[model samples]
Target: MMSPGSRPLIPGSFLKIMFNQAFPGRPGVYWFLQGRKVIYVGKAKNLSRRLKSYPRQAGFDPKTKLLLAAADHLRWQGLDSEIEAILTEARLIKLYQPHFNLILKDDKTPVYLTITKAVYPRILITRQTGTFGPFSSTRTLRQILERLRHIFPYCDQPAGSRPCFYYHLGLCPGACIGVISRETYAKNITDIQLFFQNKKKRLVASLKKEMLNFAKAQKYEPAQAVQKQLEALSYFWQARVMSLELPRLSQDQIQLELNQLFGFRVNRIETYDISNLSGTNPTGAMVVATHGRPDKAQYRLFNIRSLATPNDPAMMAEMISRRLKHSEWAKPDLIIVDGGRTQIKAVKKLIPADIMVVGLAKKPDRLVGVNKPLDLNTAAARLLIQLRDEAHRFGRRQHLRLRSKTLFI
Candidate 1:
């Protein structure tokens, strides 16, 4: 069984041995285990710092307090990046069905926007599968739904005997009033799906195409209406995309953007990642950036031994904690992890509140921070992306070396 953070401090020699033999403290997902069963699952930016905060008296949330008291041992995975951590934590929570996660077990469930399975289907808030989100901000998504409803009006209720109240408000186009044809309403539903899927570019392109078709058919007035709606969507979605928190443009640029975005001077940017063959041949890497360019001499690598099983969050957390323990290492102004929410949570605990933590999640790639997901259109985000890629490359190299050495035996 693992000790709680408030129990006692770690021994010096043990810390050294752990530093030598195990993975570096990096961002990751952790489990508060009661024997073999997981009672609760959580994530962090630094595994060491996060776990270290779990003292019996450490003022955690009520649910967390209960979870900590019941926890016997801990199991964790250090991850390659923050976004991966978020995805991994969610996946683990679903797979394990831990007792304490309110999101899973609660009756007053988180809301999801669902598209109905009907010819003239309804769009409604539901708890069903294949819906939009388990969003923290219901108001935000609801507002978006409301706004989108204006541009692409669809039925808010299933096929009804008479027109619903929303149709009069222009929130729905009165399919019940026979004012809209099936094919025309179907196109609006498709547009709604496209917007939710973050296919704004495709949706805009299609809208432009449709507008041109209208103009070509000498339907000038309809074409103008389509143009007006398309412009409105582009403007609104662009505002939502927002400017990204970036790095390595210039020393002055870094300071200015950091002050405006994350509220600090971001001179030194550090990125962490992990590589492994499933659970074996595990290696972790940290790459440093001074201003906008990489500082090659400051790069570090580790062959992970903390957990024999592959756990990306644990591996990353171990790496980051070890790094923070070293007083000699230069402190970073901003720390970038290669994954999303889980990765950010893992690292944020160890890092000072002033120092920003950012996660770059690939596959519909986004640069995410604590409560901030911004467009990755700027030069700084691109630079961070390169730095993360470099860390992964270096970590993979070390992993391959270790695997080959093992194979030779």
Candidate 2:
């Protein structure tokens, strides 16, 4: 990855250094500050990873650049869980009303969880405030409701002559069909409300008390249901809300996996591709990925000054050689050339022994010019293929633009 110190001096350099020095890699909320004013607030499942991303992101994104330039410092607070981070971020955003947070987020209205003031109060998501929240992340809030609904089985629809869709799905307690009394359904709603209020302890106590009461009365069925709810709730808390979000590999996880695969700590990867049409208007492009995400600002396109032939390996070599001359540019920990063994051999000669080099071959999509065998199904292989494809896309576009210019010339 590009070291923050190696980059040109820019606004928020101090903040970047501070972030690198020691930000906890845990769930938390962070603030970007302009002097004493808090200009933006954001939450992350991993604080250090998210905060460090801003510096690289600012290189290409106008809004990120502007926000970082305007900010002088940063602050963060580590939280125990992702749920806590989400809740704390919403509360802080509300309290500070940060300028960049609102603007960068496009001033979208925050979502709220509201309980309707009716005979059978329905839990809902709305723009207006009512009972529970001005949650910052609508998707996350919805996911939370989905998970909790399976446990509490509250209603989102009005009481009707027939059972609602959720009632059939067991996500509602059959209040709409009058199978469950209003008072009993109300108790479920209360539990949900208490959950949104962050009264986990009180909610657990209430459920425990109800379970004991049912057991004492010999109502084994209701007692067993309550016991199941208690067990599920316990598992939910221990699960850390990760299930609520879609499952995807984090960049850190990807990097670690790649590290294990390569026997080296892989951080920065550069991929090169040559694009040409019968030796005419040949172009070579380099695509960079730092810390497992593309850093578009560092992408370079070469006009292929030294080669007019359609020799891909030679063209690839020329590009790598030219790129290496610029010592000030951040060196990649790994380099991927877009060809089989021959292309890899040409580029590997130019790179130092310490820096790793590999080729992505098209047939069956495997790694070449390296001793390690990599499975195409693995995350590490997928990332390499993704970068290789990006290189091809970038080089092909530049080559087409050059060809178009030649038409007029």
C-alpha lDDT of all candidate models, in order: 0.67, 0.77
Model 2 per-residue lDDT tens digits across residues 244-276? 432357888778878988898888999999988
Candidate 1 TM-score, true structure as reference: 0.40
Candidate 2, superposed: residue stretches over 4 Å from native: 1-13, 33-37, 69-73, 128-133, 240-242, 245-409
Cα lDDT of candidate 1 equals 0.67
| Candidate 1 structure quality by residue, lDDT tens digits, 203-260 | 9999999999999999999898788678657544533211222333566664455445
Location of the lowest summed lDDT over 10 successive residues in candidate 2: 1-10
Best by lDDT: 2
Residue 277 local lDDT, model 1: 68
Backbone clashes in model 2, listed as residue pairs: none
Model 1 is weakest, by summed lDDT over 10 consecutive residues, at 1-10
